[model samples]
Target chain A: MPRILRIAGAQMGPNQRADSRPAILARMIALLDQAAEAGAKLVVFPELPFTTFFPRWLIEDQAELDSYFERAMPNPDVQPLFDRAREKGIGFYTGYAELTPEGKRFNSAITVGPDGAILGKYRKVHLPGSVEPRAGDRFQQLEKRYFEYGDLGFPAFRGPAAWHAPVLGMLVCNDRRWPEAWRCYGLQAMELMLIGYNSAAYDPNGGSTENEAIRTFHSTLAAQANAYMNATWAVSVAKAGNEDGSGLIGGSVIVDPNGVIAAEAKTLGDEVIVADADLDLCRQGQTKMFNFAAHRRPEQYRRIVDQVGAQPPGA
Target chain B: MPRILRIAGAQMGPNQRADSRPAILARMIALLDQAAEAGAKLVVFPELPFTTFFPRWLIEDQAELDSYFERAMPNPDVQPLFDRAREKGIGFYTGYAELTPEGKRFNSAITVGPDGAILGKYRKVHLPGSVEPRAGDRFQQLEKRYFEYGDLGFPAFRGPAAWHAPVLGMLVCNDRRWPEAWRCYGLQAMELMLIGYNSAAYDPNGGSTENEAIRTFHSTLAAQANAYMNATWAVSVAKAGNEDGSGLIGGSVIVDPNGVIAAEAKTLGDEVIVADADLDLCRQGQTKMFNFAAHRRPEQYRRIVDQVGAQPPGA
Candidate 1:
């Protein structure tokens, strides 16, 4: 059995802060329909796809920050998109801001089956930015202050049977750049990785030489290499273009186990890129080159678990 | 002060099994002279540069295999190349098979400083190949049968003051593809990474869809992405072209902390690729995006140390 699945990436343009809720949901539903029309069984959407990338600004009011978070998933505001996906018989992986009843917030993502059942959930573990806002900066990255570090570890689960029951994993934005997170899922034999990112066109932290091209290159480089290392198919979608006066990069890609780009987004807009991923293409790497049982030396990897920071050698 | 150190990759052409030791050393000394004339402070050479890739052959004769291993550092057989490097005031990194005093064998490498003093040593940790040879195969990868797994973990050291005394680490061949090996050095705040490889143009193991171009792409991809993720400058050289009737890849590269290629080898023969590596260029990534203290969650990465193989989710 080839175990082939047609997957889609819904790369969206900027969702301005002034954009209404209904307008954003409409765009998402349209993307889902486009993917379904292309015969895609699963579509991946970008992080914080429902609204503007709010972390670029510092929110002073509690109500304003809370408004961006979904107190409960599938709540009335976002039900239409879910209903549309179900009607089209298409599954989706999407990111959002989550708020628990106890009031804790997290940068989160979930995989919903074609029948509108949630298959898996993941919170962003590698959160970038700072808790304290930098003074004298026009745009601030306050992800550290807005959301708590994800407590749900990298977990791998099986997709619905129609999708070959593939072992699936999820990552959001910056989390895709961390190899440790990928390694955890790899140990679980994850066959497909879904990622959603809202990366800045410039250095998210002020005062660096990184530009839109370099940032986009970094995002793509991370996705390709991590996918190759883990021997899995990957779909990394982006929420890109100028959002809320800050520029976000857009180079969404669907990469194979060999790190080759199968299909890529040409513009930072509402685009649907599709690729027929042969899940078995992962076997060559998984069984030979990336055979963890034959190659991995965990005893020599103590530094990865024992330390959290770089500790340079003495003077 | 800008700590700019000019580095060169001494990518060697093939050394046929019938080639003489003096002939191989002469080629290496010529490369050393070329790098020194170009004002390079440090030069990196490929793994087992002194001999043909012996792992490709199944050597049943113990004496023949013993001839390939170096019994002592700076032995009489390889002194002229070291002398030439010292004469030019150039430091270098090179790999060689080792036959220790206790008769243990290992695939190993060393970094020699400008003054002819050894700065650091590392054994290849992720050795790729099987202990048992596949029956009816023309080429055999018997590294597992010939050498023990490297006991010395990834160790980071510093260069001489003339080379800015920058923190440096070494990984031989396949170790470069394993992110865990890089992370160990990254935890030590490694500034520059040196690598040497003799990867095949085709899958050394029989029966796969891989080819020369894809293998070369994989080699470069690993170097670029690992260098970027670890926020270090890297030089990965190759002993390329056909050796002992088997083909080898030659995409040796010099990569910056941003994962951009500074220089790359254009041929499969003797090539010298140079790059002016700014040590300060690593600061931005180390201080921001890759600041392990701020972003890494080791508590959730226990799987990396606790297991060596993939254990897929239950039935």
Candidate 2:
């Protein structure tokens, strides 16, 4: 029963577009009271982390793009970081910009738990940029002209028996470089994933083929190879610096299911880090090198869902 | 007009179950004349690169496991390393142990082409170990008691118009740590991949939780995050050290398409490692952050082809 947990991450640092909403919920309730004073019990935080990465703008006012979404999640501008993470019993995970009551828009995320409920939610299935607006780009990703794609899919849940309930999952922020949204939460054996990002430390298409240290080494090598090919225990985080002139890219990590990097983020801002994790080190890659029912084949996967694009052989 | 190519990887090192077959095709025609004197127009080579990783022992002799398969693939003892890689016009990729004239058995690989033909053939569909035989362990992965799984699926080919024909694909050695076999050859827009492995530098189920420098950093972090989430240009290679007594792992990379490490292998023995690549740097990740039709969703990847294992939430 070596479940362990502890977690943390936080990272953040840029909420500029005239930051407010009580200053980004007081820097996310001070990074959830410095990750519940370092004993952690979850935490995460990043992908929209409440604004200033508002899809790098092209808003064209619809009340300034519905004032960067969230028509309800904990409503009162995020009920004081969910009433200070349910008064510090902790458990978090973030990302936002939702909307919906028949209005639709996505790029979501969730996770909550230590009694504040919401365990797992996702939505943000690999959206990267454009839906118009790139002509002369001075920062503009527009998340496909303002959200929609993620119709809630890569699910996976549980995580409550005080973190021992580990399965958990959640992506957002370019769905951490899509390995089919971490093999659909690693076919549900998911033992803690929770990502979040802001990315674009350059190369948001106004290209020079990526910069900002190779897009922070492609965002920590896509969270250390999709958390070592789904043996789980990831973290991701990041919101990073220079938002009022777009930049982002912090390299916040955590990783390990042997993807290594146990705690990273040598600062791009609010910081926090931490680690502990263990979840039985994802049982030696889910019982010896990812025993997806003894190495999955899914009938050699139907071109991963009968093709979505890229056909180039004779094309 | 900047397609560039020049690849290479060779790698090799241990063949010893009393080596010979013209001394392993004269060490694969001396690593294909040292990757055609380093001008290398593609080379790769590893998975069962002709003998000695005989599924690490447990063989009960059927003519000694049909003397390690390959009944026809330039047979006649690998025809002088495919006539010296078609007399150095170069172009390669390897792996072996096939058999098929209906008697079945796979774990293959191919590729050939600098005019010598072949151009593509893959088999090893993520076949790893065991088909029974664990109990007293003294090394025995038995590749599921002698191959089969790869009924030819992750195809993707082309590569000829003097290398600019790119596309290509192929994976062996635990199907390069399966991202659904690199998203089924990155949905076929492939642009170069070609792997080959031998893995295990310890922990081939004797478990001490991996070693040989974290199994050569999980075999170059699964070829640099599946060649940066399939914006292609890979390589992989490696057969590496100590055979008859186990141990394997040796870096052997090449990567690119933003996964970076363009050429590695600081030896585990016979090396080669070159690079060049630049197939238009896979068009900045297939037109902006892996544009699998402006970012894949495939009905939220139906739990990666409707589940094969790990259904853990309350199960």
Candidate 3:
């Protein structure tokens, strides 16, 4: 039998300002149910599942900003999701604005096992957007202002056997664009990477988004690129469409180790897509082609870590 | 003036079984002339441009195998093409099998300036195919039996100003499939990566050629992925079509920093594609978003070097 795992990506539309946390969770659970019907034991949801893209606005009031964060993972409001998942024996991964008891904030993603136990958590290491507000942009990308850089580096996990015991890892939004993010997980030998992104179809500051197609193209390109290069499955979910007049692109997709788009969401709204990811395919990448252990010239790649970032040498 | 360099990719069909070294050089020169007509200052040609991909067969006689290699870069047979290029003030990159004076064999690629000066040379670091003969399949790939691992690592160079003086690097065939190849250039802060690949349309060993589309999709995906991730231009040329009964895939393409296929060749045969590479656009990648120097989490990626290849943790 093929080591196949039916995985689902819950592509979401934008969360409205009036969206209650309960309404969002209900939608998430409905997708989970849909995934189960499609024979998926694991489902992945879009980033910041509970609220509108909070980073789009600059909130001065502390409470208003904190409102976007999930103070605790299994709080009263989200308990239903865990219970429903446990009942179905389904595993899941979700991205949310995280607030610590001491008031520290992070863009975090958590992986939960089939038994409803938290398997592993990953904070967005490659934080994108801006730390400061730029009035010229259609929407402010103030992730830097709102959340501290994630200190918890990329980590991988071997989840419950029900989900095919996938050696999995997670990333949030902008983290997907950085090659290093995928390499870290690849180095950890992650078979499947669950990624949730809240990408603005239009980044006014970049100016390239004048044709929104560029934004979507780039978004999917990152997904396809990492999947092929790392020889791993990447399920990228997007919270797309207009949220309070701010448009975002939606091209949620499942990429095979060969970087082929096995299945993709067509609409910019709430949608669920499922596909059989033959984990055995990764074995080809591991043992035959991209077997990193045998071929990587790590001794030469030392500069990847020693340097702060790529500098145009002698520029 | 836009900091743009009009670059061309000379995508060639397979060197016919009857092709002589002189005949191949003539065809290469014709492509350069065509590129110059398109206002190109630089052109890239596919790997093993002089002869049919020889690794597809096993050779028992040493001198018989050595016949496929160029004893020196400017041997009389190739000097005419270099002279023609210098006359037209066009810089070019080409991949070929190189046999050193000391009889060292390597899958090599070299970059030359408009003035016909050798700018840089790269031996294919990630040689694909097998060393030992496997009788289970139709063709044999004995790259290990033929070439030594490259001692000279990936390096970047700034050539003549006519070619935009963009920090450039080169890789041959199998190296493009490896993410580390691109990352090495990215870490060196290269602005353009010139690559040449002669990939078989079907691998008899991997019994899935029923979907020949998968290999094509993967070839292009690898090109686009590295282009976007490294925030650099990648001009990938292919030697395709049937050579002595073995078929190769040809999808020579020019990918921008945005991972967009700025230009591509449609035919699985000899073709040329050129595009205006806005070197300044790399600034957007360098300064705005993919500023690798600022964002890469290298410290966490130490394992990429510590191990031989990626092994799932606890494997």
Candidate 4:
């Protein structure tokens, strides 16, 4: 019999600006209670689960931006929910904006064990948008102004509660768009990948509605390719629904090691998508046809990291 | 002195159902005339330049599908465009749906030399969507139903006009999504990559609008990465406009060997984007820090082609 690990992708509704931390925590606790009742060993939340997508609008003031980031994981406001999850013996993944003491901000995620202890923390690597204003008319996505590139490279850790079933990696929204994130974790032999995202509607300068399907399919295809390539079960959860008139389309999903969509959420609302993943299946996948480890030709790829526009020694 | 190729990306507007092949061919000829006037040695047209995106609707009849595909290039209608280009001594890249003599269909592109002879032919390798019906409320993307998986791998050929330039490669719409296409061509020392696409608005079922910016950015980033990594010039052209109520966004662009946007089309309409690509600059990029040829690891990847699932050994 395969050792089945039941994981729940908790797709939350939009986090309105008016919503308080206590209210969001109450909702998260309710979700944990529900997942615990459903017999889920782990529950994953979307990126920045506690707040609205702050990168969409441009904000200049430092103190104004600081208010959006959490200084500590379970500061006084979020301890009860973490305490409750520990009592229920369920490991969970959560995403938020983090503000370090050195005056730097990072989009980060944390994995909490059933015992209420933190298993590991991961900061997002690929920072989207730019600090300077763009020349075009599209909505300015000012992520570079808000968050710094993560210091942490892609590292998979062995969690205490996840020992029986090794679950190793995590990513935030924009990080999923790049294959390197999954490739890095795959190189580490990560068995399970938990990724969360918070997306907004309205084309930032509003081009055409065309390529929407391709855009979404890009993610699903990435998940499929990454899962099959890495031989790891990938669970991607999203925070859907309109926040401050910016609608977020929810296509939260759970893919098996073979890249099959086992379960997926339907709408931009609060919902739970569960999938029973067999860790052995990933081992089987890695050993079989979809193996990237066997077919990659690094001998021919020596120029991948070479910097362009570098000056010559004498020049 | 650098051997600079003046390449032009001919961004096209909508191709309506009522637009006859002759009418479309006339427009293409006009674009070619304009490109020739501008002294552009090479011109690239969008994917499926003759017709509107037929993949949007799920069709089953063979005759209807055949109608969407081109039976013969330069067959009566498009011959004028080719004749004009040949007369003008201009090499061009154009994409179309191909219906073979055996009745198999494929998304393909062809590069024609100044003498009107075919320089290279490429079929899209990455086929998106389901082979059969999808079983839910999800919007059906029927690419697998319409075209067969590509047989021809990434093959680069020498251009007619540029005697000193290196080999050039071609890729179609969906093929642009995968890095394997670029890597395959890169391994062959392709100094230039030409890609054509006709992408629809965000899929109403699979993706939301929140990912628009990243999706657009991915297009440029992919080109930039490929150009930088392979020491090549990459040009991507798009067919933009609302056709049959479906919108296609256009941001056709040109990226140099250094991964900078040398030129870009103004988002919407029939426009021409031009850039000067120097073979010597690409050679310089290849020799620099991002040189993939000098730094690859083949010993570690030994499992990429091992067959998974239930395939019988050598059966």
Across A272-295, the per-residue lDDT of candidate 4 in tens digits comes to: 888777777777656633343433
The i-RMS of candidate 3 is 1.8
Model 2 C-alpha lDDT per residue in residues A1-315, reported as the tens digit of each score? 677989988988988888787888898888889888989888889888887887776878799889888987878878878888888889898989888899988888887887788877877877887889877767787788798788878878888887778888888777788888888888888877888888878765456656798889888888888888888889989899888877788989889888889989887989889889988888888887898998898988988898898888777
In what order do the candidates fall by TM-score, top score first?
1, 3, 4, 2
Q: How would you encode candidate 3's per-residue C-alpha lDDT over A265-311 as one tens digit per residue? A: 99999999899999978877777777775666676666666776765
Q: Can you list the residue pairs that collide in candidate 1?
A: none
- Candidate 3 achieves a global lDDT of 0.84
Ranking by DockQ: 1, 3, 2, 4
Candidate 1's C-alpha runs over 4 A off are: A203-208, B204-208
The 10-residue segment of model 4 chain B with minimum total lDDT is B304-313
Candidate 1's displacement at residue B117, Å, is 0.4
**lDDT per residue (tens digit) for residues B1-315 in model 2:** 788999998988988888886898798889889889989887988988888888877888699889888888978888888888887899798989998888889888898987788988999877777898788877888798888798879888898888878889998888888888888888888878888888879865566756899878877887888888888889988898988778898899888878889889897988888989888888888887888887887888887888899887668
Q: List clashing residue pairs in candidate 3.
A: A292-B309, A293-B308, A293-B309, A293-B310, A308-B293, A309-B292, A309-B293, A310-B293
Comparing 2 and 4 on DockQ, the stronger one: 2
Which residues of candidate 4, in runs, are more than 4 Å off? Answer: A134-139, A161-163, A209-214, A290-293, A308-315, B1-315
Winner on lDDT (1 vs 4):
1
lDDT tens digits by residue: candidate 1, B1-315: 899999999999999999998999999999999999999999999999999989988899999999999999889999998899999999999999999999999999999999999999999889898999889899988888888999999889999999998999999999999999999999999999999999999855565688999999999999999999999999999999988878899999999999999999999999999999999999988999999999999999999999899988774
lDDT of 1 by residue, A1-315 (tens): 889999999999999999999999999999999999999999999999999999988899989988899998889999999999999999999999999999899999999998999999999998899998889788888999999999999989999999999999999999998999999998999889999999999855565688899999999999999999999999999998988878899999999999999999999899999999999988888998899999998989999999999998674
Model 4 C-alpha lDDT per residue in residues B1-315, reported as the tens digit of each score: 568888899989888877887788778888888888888899999998988777767777878777888888767657888889989999899998988888878989999988888989998767665667667734465776787767777777777545354578899876665555675666666788999987665554554532444345555555665565556798899888777666676778898775668999886678888887776777754653234333332222222122112121122
For model 2 the local lDDT of residue B12 reads 88
Q: What Cα-based lDDT does every candidate model obtain?
A: 0.93, 0.85, 0.84, 0.72
Interface RMSD values for all candidates: 0.6, 14.6, 1.8, 10.0
